[model samples]
Target: MTNQIYPCLWFDGQAQAAAKFYCSIFKNSKITADNQMVVTFELNGKKFMGLNGGPHFKFNEAVSFVVDCDTQEEIDNYWSKLTADGGSEGTCGWLKDKFGVSWQIVPTVLPKLLSNPDKAQNVMQAYMKMKKFDIRELENA
Candidate 1:
């Protein structure tokens, strides 16, 4: 294989299904390749490879994909779609989908707002109370 950096996700025989689901959620995404052993796909221009490695490996929150949003509507849209159907919510804008992959849906302005030492605490406090980030609240903080 060529030397290239890409996230290789392990799935228990659900690589293809996971790739399709992810493609449906993100724009400019598609499955580039698929077979019995592996599935390659792209999300927002980033490439990922999913391996049908079976149940020997399982997903955990130690690694997560962060989806940055520019507006509350965008945040809401991602939150709803990602947490739909058997997904569960976690604190600080974290969630796990049906496949057990963790995701962090956050506002693009979050880092900027939190970068200010004076307002960082307030912004963090506001985000702590929210499952889905609210841009207005962060700005007010």
Candidate 2:
């Protein structure tokens, strides 16, 4: 048997709506199924299932979807859109969308920059000060 792992998002009642919103944001994404119990979707080729499980559970920062972008434009684009409407921004590129799902919009180079021993502290300092990530600033740090 082939084993596969996919994230299942728990939603109070907006599973389909949240899935649709995610699909609209990422490339190569789509809604594969929708029904009273669940909504299945894909984002950037990753499969996700959203369950309309009721008010028993809610989303928090413990788990978040991270979006890694190659350019500042991509980062900005995603950050702006995700934080738009009723979404609120958090420090270090974290945010919660209108549906209360957490996300991190980060540049692809962030990890590499932070991995450098000489620059790690500076990079971290710069990163901790911003709501959205800026690749150039991190690089400069």
Best by lDDT: 1
Residue-by-residue lDDT tens digits, candidate 2, 1-141: 268799999898899988988889889999999998899998998899999899998889999989888999998889888887899999998999998889998898987998999999999999989988888889999
lDDT tens per residue, model 1, 8-106: 999999999899999999999999999999999999988999999989988999999999898888888888888888989998899999899999998
User: Which whole-number lDDT from 0 to 100 does residue 72 have in model 2?
Assistant: 91
Where's the lowest-lDDT run of ten residues in candidate 2?
Answer: 1-10
Clash count list over all predictions: 0, 0
Summing lDDT over every window of 10 consecutive residues in candidate 1, give the lowest-scoring window. Answer: 130-139
Candidate 2 TM-score versus the reference: 0.94
RMSD, each candidate, Å?
A: 1.4, 1.3
Error of 1 at 96 (Å): 0.7
How many backbone collisions does model 2 have?
A: 0
For every model shown, what is its TM-score relative to the native structure? Answer: 0.94, 0.94
